[model samples]
Target: MGIAEEQSKASAALASSKTTSSSRDSASTAPAQRQAGKIDVLIQGVALFSDGYNIQIIGYMNTVLAKLYPKQMTTQVKTRLSNSILIGDIFGMLLFGLCIDRFGRRVGIILTTLFLVFGIILATASHGATVEGMFWMMVTGRGVAGVGAGGEYTVCTSQALECADSTPEMRRRRGMLVAVSTNAAIISGFVGSSIVSLIVIAAYGGKPSDGIWRICFGIGIILPLAIFFFRMRLNDSEQYRKHAIHSKMPYWLAIKFYWRPLLGCCSAWFLYDFVVYPFNLLAPTLVSGFSKDQSMISSIGWSALVNFFALPGSFIGALLMDRIGRRQTYALGWSIVCDFGFAIGGSMIQLKNIFPLFVVLYALFQTFLSVGPGDCNFLVSSESFPTPLRGHFLGFAAAIGKVGAAIGTTTLSEALASFDNPTKGQQAIFLIGSAISVVGTLCVWFLIPDAPVNLEDEDVRFRNYLEANGYDTKEMGLSASNT
Candidate 1:
């Protein structure tokens, strides 16, 4: 049943559960109570920017690391290097996911950012007497950093969503706000790493050195360091203040009420990342394939340019989010990308030769990838559930997406190796990605629901659901602002 219908059904009992001392009306959806300040936007932006930069920057440095430590960086080692952060992310998501729901967003974001700073410092300084030892140290550091970045995925998203949900206007635009604020921030981080890597390499006169990779890993620390301080000044989102379950949580009751959405959000995220991470992490490698003799600088530059196209796609998705709804925007972007993937992969031979035209086509393909799935992933995942357990569910969904990314990333060399010709392997990727996008489109179409008619609609409905099932709604949402 819809939230509105459920809210209406529970209206009679609302007075019994009203807050004891707070002036804000529990039943009202008024704008005067919440302003959604610039700090909200700032926190979301930097948190995501730091996250994107730290996670994707490692992929940008693979070639440089391979050059510096070829003996130690074998195929198996390469896979471990790429997947370590992803593995770390799953752990962080689960741990902090539950932590934030139990404690508060303020606690989660602070700890996660500290993890980012500590991980980067350890990674940037990674060294040992033996070359293999150094590589091992770097991998260990990145895995820890990945944990912090992974935790940010849920904390930033839910915080930003709540911040934007204070008014009718903001609630309608909540999808856009969360997408633009957090999801789009990731593209910035990802693209920034590509550009920064090229710059760092050029500074060393196009040669690989210990300093180059160290500088690349070390530079990411600044953003998170700043994020840690800013997060401390913040209070938990008002929604969290009202609906958070501080005492013993009704886990089985929540499962009974939310299992369908949990399944849908988790699976949708997995499918999106399965397509997104491979295409994303492999963009430079794929573009480099188009030119037999292009310098490393040129390939990376082109990849940066192609990834830059994601900005426009993010803006487009933000515009469509409230206008058309999250489900429609997500399915629409994937559908178009599905066509592009087939066309580009099927015609790889001819397009690869034309060079400039191929970049444009591939760029347009990446742009749309940003538009739908890119934009909607964070926003949709957050909106799919209620506030009390948003951190838990959202973190779980994101962690699942990382799993898809790890699988997809590992598929890269393995998939390519299975083919005889380079063009055939590349073609296989496009066709596979296209087929996956088709499945992704259908998954969102049926499984995910549209967003709320009001910001607290789900929270209110959740209260009714719990109270009817013998859970205490008032004992929950203990104030965190004071403690």
Candidate 2:
């Protein structure tokens, strides 16, 4: 045979061999077993990394900065530090999203570890250096850690959402993976807050409490290292690899296709952070306003105990989100947030007398807040796009949310500082936050698509197009056009 014919024959033989091998491998595994194992691992990994940072970082940001920059750490300064972290988050999100699909979740995670290490070292080093210099270093450290968090949030979630088998039973199971991270976050928040309270109480007994924040920061470094080492055992997801090879697009085309869902996701996130970021960042100052005495410090301890109540609410929210759908669950959560804000506003108006009432109301707010926004945002954002764009979509969504978070801190700070009475101004901020949350809840309901729970139900408009074009249901596994 001539060379051209020989090459053609050889190519055909290789294709046949690969098909046979693929078929054999598919035949060997029980579908149920394979789906269960992969989805579970995905959920666990996502949960591990998310909770690992949020619990420590979110709980301590206010207190940590307050200790280091007591004189200069106004709400605006605190917000700027937060903004710096967000700047890093934006870069990491784009970088990780661009590469995660192309390279794989495992590789992206390994890269994230480097950012985490750098962040931790810089942040910790701030403590060792002069106080003024430490302020900038602390911001630098948070920025690096944020880059790692940016990678972790998008890549890990996309890996879980995309890799699950396209079956109803498997999809519900897979949804749990997305919830795991937030669940960890809620749990960690409770733990971190408790630690803060314990340190405060110890100070009431004359022990030095100034150093406690440093311990939290030091401990924060350990979680990422542990996650990095654990993730080293995980493999690159098969579905992502398969999709990368089969449907790869020019980068521009992918962005064009995904812009709408991406925008919707990011907008939802922006609203979420508007309340949560500032609330957490300025919590220490807010608490201090009530009292600086031993009794007042004990109130914070009581508040920490109350925060634990949010954990269960989050667990239930995650379960119902998968059942009732993302839109409804999110809208419901925000509605509660708005009402909670009103309650908070009322308590702030009477801060001296209704301290117990404020703590109780705040606890309830924390519960639903922990469960609803965090989990729903991840679920909706991760599922909003096709596998190719999932990482980019989620990364950008998170970056926007961080921006909102940064603004929230500054706005709250300015509001607190400028007010004739800082306490009443806080009440006004709550009222405004309540209105914003309601608007966000409305946006999700009116504008966004009904996110499909499984891969088979996706590309819904495209599915309709296929049916209209005379595609057969059995051959394509697509619904025929009712039209």
Candidate 3:
């Protein structure tokens, strides 16, 4: 069948399934019961706040740590410290994703939370007799925390999307809910880090204080631990439960069936991170580099200010996805917003009199990214596969994306160092980032297919596809309702 014909069939199937599901929905529960489901969705969405907060805290630490331990903040040391969490994330995404697929989402999330708590405690208490010991300790702690935060991507995102799909009211708003949940967490991270920074600076009389960094790391423990209590109370989504009860696709078979989406999601995420992490993690340094007169506090405050603009951009992108479709949103954000921003911003970075212009362009670049591929990537990864493989696919894609983040974080310093002038080096990195964004745009356009998927109908379609392909549906416990 032609691509258009296939899409038309899928849409019709989804519409019919939605109608049927709506009829059954009124009979399935009382009004209070429905209201409770909405509450659950909200809780799950908020669960991501910890992940977002932790990720950005590290970025904020770049400036704070540089001042607190200037001796150990060498380029190599800084790179190691910056990438520790990301290194952990690389493994965590893979491990937690597999755990969710095999053991269940609840189990995976609980374990992830425990790791997060342990990592936070280790990082908060990090100290040693020598600078080496202290640096490694912090790196180790952040790496551990990164593992938990990494797992959150697979566990939390999959759960939020699944929960949204389980409810009719939420299903239509899944794009916004997922995007807002993740982006809100990011915004919270930016806000939380800024508040903590101001408080620490004030208490210490604006001096470089180790206690400030420790306190900031320690504060990350609160939200995750609190959410753990609620997550334990929550149950797996109806879609996952149904899939788990009826059938489990073999790992190899899932790979065989969904390789196209795996490639699309993985590449898209990889490219997004490749461009995003370098700028994001280096935001403080970038701002500081642009204007030598800017203080540490000013640099951090500027970084936070840039992130504030990202909040609306994220919501706008999600809303556009619902209205114009994911492909268009992704393409527009990449080509128009991110690509142009990076190219123009890089070219202008060396302009001595127009430093503020560079900052504005940089902020606009980030804002456009959040609107386009940032949150949309998560939505695409989760929705691209059926329930049985959703976690696995999303996890794998996320893990690979982390690799991109790691590369971006690691190489950015090297890129900056290669040039004599810091501003010129930053210009080089930004131009390179723009080139990478262009490649990412092409990947989204050609590789990622646009399919309007309804979760219930998708499950049925997968079941039938398996059966028609000579797989034993009966053995897998496929039921009429599931089809």
Candidate 4:
């Protein structure tokens, strides 16, 4: 061969050898990397399980508070008590959402646990100069806890999504893992709250006593601390490491590209939570209206059982997410809920006469709640955007959803107080929720865009989109330590 041709062939051969060696290195690490991703997601999800348990258990605790401090647990006090974390959700979601995007997932995740620990410890040890003062102290403590809980929605889901994107095998099931695995924990939290309250109340011989209230609040501290340690062991997700913005983001440029999907995500979450949280908060109340002879404890057990039905629904949603995609699956779930809700709400009078049947139908309605919006909100919020902006959009959507939860809870409480018959009030909740679901369905069709499941894929599109709009993509990426 000629001298020039010989030099070119030698250079190409050396480059190919280096590429093969790199592939070998990546192949060797892939399994461990995948396993670490699973561990990371599991740890984050456990905190959510605790969150579900901690937050929902309060409904049962509220019953105890009313009995123990008749003069203290006023309607207004109860409202604040129920909404404390929900109100906290707004601030937590907003602040932590921004922080996670700006700082890093590790920083946001670790800091959040401290808030939870403080909130839980302060709440469990709630004390003041007087009984009335103590109750407000409890409210403040829970509000703090709510902030932690609110932040969890943003950080946990974002972290979990990135973790699921760690490998192709994992990425294919990302919908099921991110949506069902973590969300099921939240739903299970609802179940755990009900069941644990039932067990604790049973320990107290079917009573909502001082001890019952304290124990329930105390149990919330465990997971936050456990996960705090787990979180310390974690590095930022590889995806976050790869594409996270190292400098100030161009907000105007981001909006130019993402605004449409952002609107859909925020609106869907708001409507879904508005429809769902009220029914969840008032489960015992609804059960009591139907089962006139049951005691408060019996109603709590039934609520647990009712919430259990959502677990299956969440799994079904996960499957649907993969098969049909996010927008379609969410729409189908909402449509089913709307139909069943209208039927159940309209038939309340007749169904009350057949209470067992009513319970089944009520649970079935709750099932679809998880199947559709419960699954969709987190998946859509976390997935539609790239890693750098995932926290922002997810947090914004969650914060808006919490506002809906707060308003829905308050409005339903008003409906219950306004109506002469309690059944009428529940009927109103079902019907109104169904109508809201219809609006939610429309948002999905018109606004919500379908997104790729893989983090790398979405990041590419986002980077390219930004470049098209005169923004730089080179400034984003991991440092050598991050890689």
Which tens-of-lDDT digit does each residue in 1-483 have in candidate 2?
Answer: 343353344334543444643553354332332333553445445434443444335344455445545787665556656666667777777789877866667788788878867786777667535665667777888788778766777766775566554455556655555665544453554456566546644654624354555555566666667656656665554444323421233455444445566677888888887877666555555666666563434544554555565667667776887678778888788888888888788778775577667767767776676666766887788777655456767787877887787677677678877788767877877787787888888877875667764543343332232233343322211011111
* Model 4, residue pairs in steric clash: 85-146
Weakest ten-residue segment in model 4 by summed lDDT: 25-34
Regarding lDDT, does 2 or 4 come out ahead?
4
Which is better, 1 or 2, measured by TM-score?
1
Best by TM-score: 1
lDDT of 3 by residue, 1-483 (tens): 443454455445554555544544444432232222555655655656766667767777768788877777898888887788888988889998888866678898788988888998998898889988988898999899989888988888888778777767788887777777665555566667766776776677766678878888888898887778887776666666445523355665566666777898899899888778777778788777767777667787887777666667887887887778888888888886656556664575455457776667777888888777886788889888887677778989999998998898777778988889886787778788888888888888887767445676766555445544566544332122244
Model 1 global lDDT (CA atoms, 0 to 1): 0.81
What TM-score does structure 1 among the candidates reach?
0.92
User: Which residue ranges in model 1 land beyond 4 Å of their true spot?
Assistant: 1-35, 479-483
- Over 1-483, each residue of candidate 1 has an lDDT whose tens digit, in order, gives 664454465555555544431443453343343456656754787878978888788777877777787887776777788888888889898888899998888888778888878888888999899988888898999999989989888788878888888667677677777888887899889888998999998999887798988999999998887667766666777787777887778888777677777877788789888887777777777887776786667777888888888878998999999899888998999999998988998898888678788778778888888888888888878877889888888899899999998998888656965777878888888888889889888988888887876557677767877777677655656543233
- Estimated TM-score for each candidate: 0.92, 0.80, 0.89, 0.90
The clash tally of candidate 3 reads 0
lDDT of each: 0.81, 0.62, 0.74, 0.80
